[model samples]
Target chain A: MNQLLFFAGLKEAAGTENVNMDLAGLTVEEVKKKVFEVYPSEQLQTSMVAVNEEFAGQEHKIEEGDTIAFLPPVSGG
Target chain B: MNGKQVWVTEEPLSPGEIISRVTRRDAGAINTFIGTVREFTKGKKTLYLHYEAYPAMAEKKLQQIADEIEKQWPGTTTVMAHRTGRLDITDIAVVIAVSTPHRDASYAASRYAIERIKEIVPIWKKEHWEDGEEWIGNQKETKPGVPTKEESR
Candidate 1:
């Protein structure tokens, strides 16, 4: 199972902190698209992604057991 | 040898402590920036703010900021501390300290550090207002007049 995590505003938008999915073989972009399909947010289209805690490109592949996060534009100062 | 000077603490951030971390006998000037939770933003009354982060990744990015500072200003040491959890109006949210042998480098490096943090750090903030609450994720948040998911219902 792959673990998906959410943070901050995304957490409320995701409605849960963690999710388990069988996302193996899917690219990061595909995984993100799936998330948006499930959560259905317009603002989410602009979200960035991270795989295994590192910022990942859209084309990066998601392997078995990889944790993914949809980071909605960061606002830290 | 260089040391890790970046930190994410739940306790209130102090510019003094951050400055002390980067201070050395060879340093001539120290520059500091403090981020505070203000009572108003764009005419809205902010009751408080809640900050959150993916701790491990947040720290890693902060370390990257420190490294970038050293690269840009040789002989400079930078330290930054960010606080999490709920904060009231006027609370200090973040403190950045940079020390160098000269004032110009110290000032420039300190300025660069804060902007870089805003651009790259994985931390986020949710602002509580009198009428409603808004999670400010990115710098380009839409106008305050828009309703949140809860409000839109």
Candidate 2:
């Protein structure tokens, strides 16, 4: 299972903070594709992805038990 | 290296607390920068500020900043703490403290910490003005030759 977390504006936009998916052998991009497929209208294009607390590009591989987090652009001063 | 120290909290951050964390007998100079929620911005009446973070990424980037400082300036200690959730006027939004053997190193490291944190850390702020609240992304006044949002990405 993969654990997905959303924060800030992305969380508000998704209307949920987290989800657990049972995709065992998918890459990070594939998981992102599935998330957008489920929430078709949500904006995933501009969000950033992280795996195991590290910033990751879409091509990174995802394994079972990895924690994935999506982050929107930061605006803080 | 003492390692990177980070605190993400909703309560007000104390300058003394942050100072204590980074202080060491080997370091003579310490520099700190405190970011507060101001009551005015461009003639608008600001009520409060709301801060949010991609907790995992924020912490990671903060550690990267700390590491970079240690690489650039040897024997310096750094600490960065940011408050999440709501903050009232005069409340510290973020605090950065650096200790070094010399004053210049402390200043440079502290400034670098804040600048890099702003540029890379996934922390966002919303200004709750009298009219409405608006998110302020990574937009800021830039120095010439420095990278813009598009350039950085």
Candidate 3:
């Protein structure tokens, strides 16, 4: 099972810090689309994805038990 | 030494501590940028700011920024520390410290560190206002009418 993590606004919108999914051979882009299906939000549309502590692109492949983090637009100093 | 270069802490950020990270016998100049929470944004009276980060990734990107600064300005070392959790107005939010043998390198390196953090760090902020509150997007972009889960209509 892969865990989908949400932060800040996305966490609130999804109503949970994380959700579990059976993601096998799914590209980051595919997983993103599925996330939208599960927890649709306008903010999630623009949220960037990260896999294993690195910013992941739509084309990046996901692995088993990997942590997929959905980050809303960053606003750090 | 690498992990020591960047941090995400819940303690009140100290610009001096960040500067201490780079102090060395050879360093003759140090440059620092301290970012503080303000009392107002646009016209809204900001009550406070709530900050969060993908901790592992935020620290990773902070190191990346430090590395980039080292490459661009030889002989310089960078230190970046960001505060997480709720921060009241006038609180110190972040500090980027750079040190080198001279002023020029430290100045440019410090500038590069802050800009790169804003562009790449996986951090988020929620602005609490007197009337309402909103989560600020990448680079603090705020949009009206977008509802949080609690207030979704």
Candidate 4:
């Protein structure tokens, strides 16, 4: 199982901080589609994906036990 | 050391404490940038702000920013602190301190730190207004003058 995390407005839209899924072998882009199907948001399109706390591109592969995060446009000072 | 001078805390941020972290005997100048919550934004009266972050990743990113500054301006030390949780109007939200052997480098590096933070840090702020609350930079946000999700609820 892989853990997916959300933050900022994405958290509010997803209604939770994290979710677990069996996502091994899936590409980051595929995982994003699954997420949008579950919790649809336009923000997901612009958000960056991070795997295991490091930035990952859409084609990056996901493995078991990986932790993925969806980050929206940051507004921190 | 990784992340020794970077922090993401729930407690109120203090510029003084952050500045002290970057102080050096060989440094001739120190530049500090303090970010405060404003009472109004885009003509809306803000009640308060709620900040959140992916703590582990945020600290990593902040340290990366500091490393970038050092590479760009050698002989510089940088410290940054960002406060999370609820913040009232005028409350200090973030502080960045950079010290270098010269004033020009200190000023430029300090500015670079803040800009990099906004770009890469895994931190965010939700603005609470009298009429509604919206996560700043949420692309799907309700347009101004329209009823917001919170307002309609």
Candidate 5:
């Protein structure tokens, strides 16, 4: 099982901070699709996905026990 | 070597402390950039601002920015801090300190750090106005490197 984390507005839209999904061997794009199915939102489309604290491209392969995060465009100074 | 060079904290950010971390004996110049909350933005009266972040990832990205600065401008030391939770008007929101052998590199690196934070760090701010509140950059039209709707207005 992989833990999917949400931050910023995505967290508010998802209604939770994180979720566990069985997502081994799936690509980051596929993970996004599966996650949206559970908590559908357009914000997820614009978010940048990260795997294990590093930004991941859509084709990046997911491994078991990986931690995934969805980050919206930042507004920090 | 305090190991607090890049951090996200709920407590108020101290510019003096952040500047001290980057101070080096060989550095002839140090540039500090402090971002503060204001009462008015885009003609709206902001009551306060609430900031949130993916703490672990935010710190990682901040360190990445510092690394990029050090690479781009060799011999430069950089430190950054961002305050989370609620911030009132005139309160410090973020601080970036850069020290280099010369003034030019120090200024450039400090500017680069702040811009990269907005571009890549996993921090977000929600503006509370008298009429309403919204998360900045959360709109579909608001993308990095593009002027946000509020900004364009």
Candidate 6:
């Protein structure tokens, strides 16, 4: 299982801050697909993902116990 | 023994505390900038400001800003602390302090740090006005005499 965290605007849009995905050896894209399946109305198209605190693209593979974060573009000063 | 020191907190920030952190015997010039919550905007009375951030990314971006300053000005000490959560009027929102042997370097680095922070850091501020609260984000194209919603449209 992997722990996923969402922050800022993404959290507000998703309506939940964090979730645990029980998909071992799945790619990041697969995880994102699961998220979309769970929240079909969510605006996941514009969000970005991070793995282990580093910005990651969709192709990045996820291992067991990995920490994933979904982030929306932030506007802060 | 060198490089930049950074601290990010949800507690209210104090300019005096930040100043004490970077002060050293070798530094001759220390420049600090404090961002505060204002009382009025567009004729609306503000109640408070709420700040939020992507903790990991914010900390990383702050470190990069400090590294850039160090490269531009050698032997410079920089400290930047931004507050999160709710803040009332007159509360310190952000504090940036830079120390250098000369005033020019201190001023330059301090200015650069604040500008870059506003540009790249993932922190958002929501202004709570008497009537309502509005989130201010991506002011990249803000212009005079243009209403925010009209501009978006």
- The model with the greatest TM-score is 5
- For each candidate, give its TM-score against the true structure: 0.89, 0.84, 0.91, 0.90, 0.91, 0.78
TM-score of chain A of each: 0.91, 0.87, 0.94, 0.96, 0.97, 0.84
Clash pairs, model 1 backbone: none
Q: Rate the local accuracy (lDDT) of all candidates.
A: 0.80, 0.77, 0.82, 0.84, 0.85, 0.74
Per-model DockQ: 0.47, 0.33, 0.48, 0.42, 0.46, 0.23
In terms of lDDT, the best-performing candidate is 5
Rank the models by lDDT, top first.
5, 4, 3, 1, 2, 6
How does model 6 score by TM-score? 0.78
Deviation in Å, model 1, residue B143 alpha carbon: 16
Best by the DockQ measure:
3
**Tens-place lDDT digits, model 6, residues B1-153:** 223366567877778878887899999999999988889877889999888887777788788788888888999988888888988999888899999998999989988888777665667788888777766754554322112332111
Candidate 4 lDDT over residue span B2-112, tens digit each = 336898999877777778788889999999999999997778899999999999999998988888888999999999999999999999999999999999998899888
Which residue runs of candidate 4 sit more than 4 Å off their true CA positions?
B1-3, B138-153
Over the stretch B1-153, how does candidate 3's per-residue lDDT look in tens digits? 334889998888877666778889999998889999999777779999999988888988888788777888889988889999999989999998888999988878888778777767888889998788888885534332222322111
> Please, what are the lDDT tens digits per residue for candidate 5 over residues A15-72?
9999998999999889889999998988888888889987787788999999998888
| Model 2, runs deviating above 4 Å | B1-4, B140-153
Residue-wise C-alpha lDDT for candidate 3, range A1-77, written one tens digit per residue: 89889998999999999888988689988988888898998777788777887777777889998988888878988
What TM-score would you give candidate 3 relative to the actual structure?
0.91
lDDT of 5 by residue, B1-153 (tens): 357779999988878878889888999999999999989887889999999988998898898888888889999998899999999999999999899999999878988887677777789999998888888973334453323323211
Looking at candidate 5 chain A, the ten consecutive residues that score lowest on lDDT are A68-77
Q: Per-residue lDDT of B1-153 in model 2, one digit per residue for the tens? A: 233497566777888988998889999999999988888888898899889887656777787888889999999888888888988898899999899999989989988888887777878888897778876754644332223444233
Better of 4 and 5 by DockQ: 5
Error of 5 at B140 (Å): 13
With candidate 1 superimposed using the best TM-score fit, by how many Å does residue A33's alpha carbon deviate from the native?
Answer: 1.6
